[model samples]
Target: MAMLTIKDLNVYYGVIQAIKGISFEVNEGEVIALIGANGAGKTTILHTITGLITPKAGSIDFEGNDLVKIPAHKIVSLGMAHVPEGRRIFAELTVLENLKMGAYTRSDKKEMENTLEMIYKRFPRLKERKNQIAGTLSGGEQQMLAMGRALMSHPRIILMDEPSMGLSPLFVSEIFDIIREISESGTTVLLVEQNAKKALSIADRAYVLETGNIVLSGDAKELMNDDSVKKAYLGE
Candidate 1:
């Protein structure tokens, strides 16, 4: 079954439409990349899916539930987590505190502890800086913390926006590797990126959006090899 399904979604900022009735589905355990340039409504789509922006039309269904009507915090409790474009870690808080905030909706202490340990194991850098303020960490470390905090919620699907933005090439590769690892560990991922080549390389499937509409979509390898995609996004 598809993990998340969006049907004829139209999102508007007042009278100005940002998403023009786009639609897609994300299957369980898949890494689905939404690649487009800035202002193509990529981030808008993520925001709409996570209930941060109310859609002007259409439906958002996750795990077979109608998510369009749910509140943002309620949506998170229903197993979807969103890591927005910016690494929005709490700068003033300790790393541990930020992680704890992610689990605010959960009550299972044992499971929370297990998840925390898993996050620490996955990003040992976070463990080393557990007591340090988030603002003190380097960019790459802060990105790791953002991801780790999202994982603390034990979400079934994660929506990531421009996770590679502003990182060095090495860190960019590392971030994608971690995304793959996270997907393999049972969380489906829907990724939005301006770094089209890198996003398509790791994605199981990809969708190309232009001016808020889907212009192309297919298996990642096929999209990567497409002449137009190569010219436009791959710098060929």
Candidate 2:
């Protein structure tokens, strides 16, 4: 079964429409990338799915539940975790504290500790900086922390937006590698990214969005090879 599905979703911002009837699905254990240029409404789609923004019309179904009617905080408990666009970690909190916050919805203390250990094993840097203030970390480290924090929720599906937005090439590569590892480990991922080549490289499937609509979608390798996609997105 598809892990998450968005159907005929339309969203508006004030008088302007940001997303127009775009629909897609992320299947279990698949890495799905939504690639688009700035203002193409990729983040808008994610915000709607996470309940940060409500759609004017459509349905967001995840694991047989309608996300549109659920509260944002409740969405987390339903096993949909969102790693927002900006690496929005709690700036004042220590890395450990920030990670703990991610588990606020859970009452399973023992399981949360195990997840924390798993995260630390995945990114030892986070373990090294566990006591450091989140704001003091470098951009790359902050991004790592954000992903680590999201994983603390032990989510069934992870939604990431622009994870490589501001970082050195090395960090960007590292982040994508981690994403691949995360997917391989069986956590379904829905990625929104402007770094088309990198996103397409790791994606199982991809959808190209243009001006609030999906213009192309298929296997990642196929989209990577398309002439139009190459010129417009892959910088080929």
Candidate 3:
């Protein structure tokens, strides 16, 4: 069974439609990339799935439960974590404090501690700066903290929005490597990215969105080699 399924999904902000009736599915343990240009509604699709924006029509099923009716907080408790765009870390909080906040919905102290240890293992920089304030961290470190914070939730699936944005080439590669490591460790990933080639290269499957609609979708390898994708997104 799919870990997440969206059918006939639509979203709007007041009178303007942000997402058309789009559908997709994320299977357990797969890295699925949603690739698109700016304002293509990729982020909007993520927001709707996570309940950050209510859908005007359609259904979102996560592990067989209806997500449209659930509140955002409740959705998080259901094992869906979203690392939004712009790395929305709490600027004034310490790295450790920020990680703790990710587990606010959980009460199992032992498990939380284990997860924290795991995050530290995955991001040694975060461990080194656990006591440092978040706002002072460099861009690369801030991205790591944001990702680490999401992992603290022990989510079954993570929704990441433009995680490689605004990073140096070295940092972009590092972030994608981390994403691969996370997927190998058994978490499903739904990634939205503007860097289409990089994202498709690492994904198991990919969807192409344009102007608020999905234009194409298939195995990532195939999409990466397609002429149109190469010309339009890969700068080939």
The sequence of per-residue lDDT tens digits that candidate 3 reaches over residues 1-236 is 78899999989899998888999999999999999899999999988888889999999999889999998889889998999999999999999999999999999999999999999999999999999999999999999999999999999899999999999999999999999999999999999999998899889999999988899999999999999999989999
lDDT of 2 at 132: 96
Question: Model 1 misses residue 84 by how many Å?
Answer: 0.7
**C-alpha local distance difference test of each model:** 0.93, 0.94, 0.94
Residues 14-120 of candidate 2 have per-residue lDDT tens digits of 98999999989999999999998999999999999999999999999998999999978799989989999999999999999999999988899999999999999
Instruction: Pick the winner on lDDT between candidates 1 and 2.
Output: 2
TM-score of each: 0.98, 0.99, 0.98
RMSD of 3: 0.7
For model 2, which pairs clash? none
Say which prediction, candidate 1 or candidate 3, comes out ahead on lDDT.
3
Indicate the residue-level lDDT of 12 in model 1.
87
